[model samples]
Target: MSKIVVIDPGHGGKDPGACANGLKEKDIVLKISKYAKDYLEDGYEGVKVYLTRSTDVFLELSERAKFANNKKADLFVSNHINAGGGTGFESYVYTTINGGTTEKMRSAVHNEVMTVYKGFRDRGKKKANLAVVRETAMEAMLLEHLFIDTKKDADFLKLDDNLKAIAKAEANGIAKALGLKPKTVKKEAPKKEAPKKDIPKKDGKLSKVQVGAFADPKNAEKLAAELKKKGYKPFITKE
Candidate 1:
């Protein structure tokens, strides 16, 4: 069975989760979430990814969780950006679930993100009563990508390549957690060149043909004898 994952980009439309360095959390998280969905679906087999909100539209915290439940998702991941004078990345799961599937998923995803977001501080795996994580039916986690208000972190997030790397990591983590296999790509066979046709000359003349060229006189004589047996007017000329 295919594993279903619902990715929520927190704070859209009227609610911009965080704002810093001339960037809005709503926009950034949406981009990262979309990239993550694309990477997961493209790179892995037996997985289905869906976004809570693909556009800059508003969705209540409860609505996000409900959406995941409606899709019967196996995992729910909410993407967010942090503010308030802090820098680095962190992941959160429901406070009550410990040492279960949720924690395992959280660890898998957290470690994957850390691998890509090198040089960024690791805020450690944590527990929270966040609405999305708490309300989701399946194993769920939330990710605080980086402190948008922090200058250093904000500069890094500004690069599209950096966002793509984060998305790739998230996809890889989910794949690992679900034991999803990589998609097999079929390779095309090489084409063969057509055989050359023997065309007559434009002047209606035939090209010269050499049937046999033997260095030894004995070999030449043997070829002539064989041709004569085949009713070919056999002749041997010495060059």
Candidate 2:
């Protein structure tokens, strides 16, 4: 069965979760979420990814969770950007869940993001009563990418490539956690051979031998005579 994954871009439209250094959490999370969805679908097989909101639109926390539940999602990943004075990456699961699939997924995702976003502070896997994570029916996790208010973190988040890296990391983590297989490309069919042209024939036989092309008729005749002596049926043709 195809595993269904719901990616929630934390804030949008009127609610820009956090804003700092001219960056809005709503926009950044949306980009990250879209990239993650693309990476997961393009790289893995038997997985269907859905986004709570694909555009800049507001969605209540309860609505996001309900959307995932409606889709019967196997995993719910809520993407967010931090704005606290501190800088780093962190992941959160529901405060009540422990030592289960949610925790395992949180570990996988956190480690993968930390691995890709190297040199950044590892804020560690944590638990929170965040609405999206807490309200979701399936295993859910919220990722705090980095502090938008922190100068260094915001600068890093400003890069499009960095966002893509983060998304790819999250996709990798999900694939690992779910044991999803990479997509296998089907081999192309062998091309058909071109039709063969009829070989030039002299009378009813194939013309296999070519005689000499000489500037002088005498020279051509001499070569043809030699070819005849050698048992080759040679005929001289003038250009």
Candidate 3:
């Protein structure tokens, strides 16, 4: 049976989460979770991963925990960005349960991710009664990637490359803990060449990836706020 990992991106939609220095926790966590999911799917085998919420959608805390429990996930990892008076990477596991595969998994992920965040302070691994971790049946952990309130941390997270790097580290760590192997990508056989035909030249243009278009300006503004947190200068075009 494949090992099941459920990733929960903390806060979304109605919940803006912790906001500071023009950064929102909801946006950062979502981006990290999405990138992690993609990396694991494309590079690893014998693992099935699921997200509590895929997009900007509000989910109750209980609902998030229930989703993982219902799925019988082998592990639950919740992603979040911190706020208020701290700047660094910190991870949490259940307070009572210590020293086992769970702690090893937490350490594996924390070490891998913190290595990339070398300049940032190492807050160290901790234990807490966080809803998702406490409620989930499987071994669970929650990660505070960095502090949104801290200028240095927020600036680092604002870069797209940093987000991708963090995601890769976490995903790779999870794969390592699960003893996963890279999937074998099949190579296609080369085909015989055909005679060339005349083709017309086309004008070059820049392309943009859009998240959504909303009828209400409030909704549009919300998306723009989230995008801004991701270091995007998004503007809504009226039609």
Which candidate leads the pack in lDDT? Answer: 1
* Model 3 local distance difference test score: 0.90
Query: Rank order by TM-score, top first?
Result: 1, 2, 3
TM-score of each: 0.78, 0.77, 0.77
Model 2 C-alpha lDDT per residue in residues 87-189, reported as the tens digit of each score: 8999999899889888888888889889877778999889889999888999999999989999999999999999999999999999988989988767855
Q: Which wins on lDDT, candidate 1 or candidate 3?
A: 1
* Collision pairs in model 2: none
On TM-score, the stronger of 1 and 3 is 1
Compare candidates 1 and 2 on TM-score and give the better one.
1
Give me the displacement of residue 86 in model 3, in angstroms.
1.3
Please state the error at residue 212 of candidate 1 in Å: 28
Q: What digit string (tens of lDDT, one per residue) describes model 3 on residues 1-239?
A: 89899999999999989999888899989999999999988899988899999999999999999999999998899999998879899999988976999999998899999988988999999999888999999989999999998899999999989999999999998988788898886784445633222233465444666779888989999999987776567789888
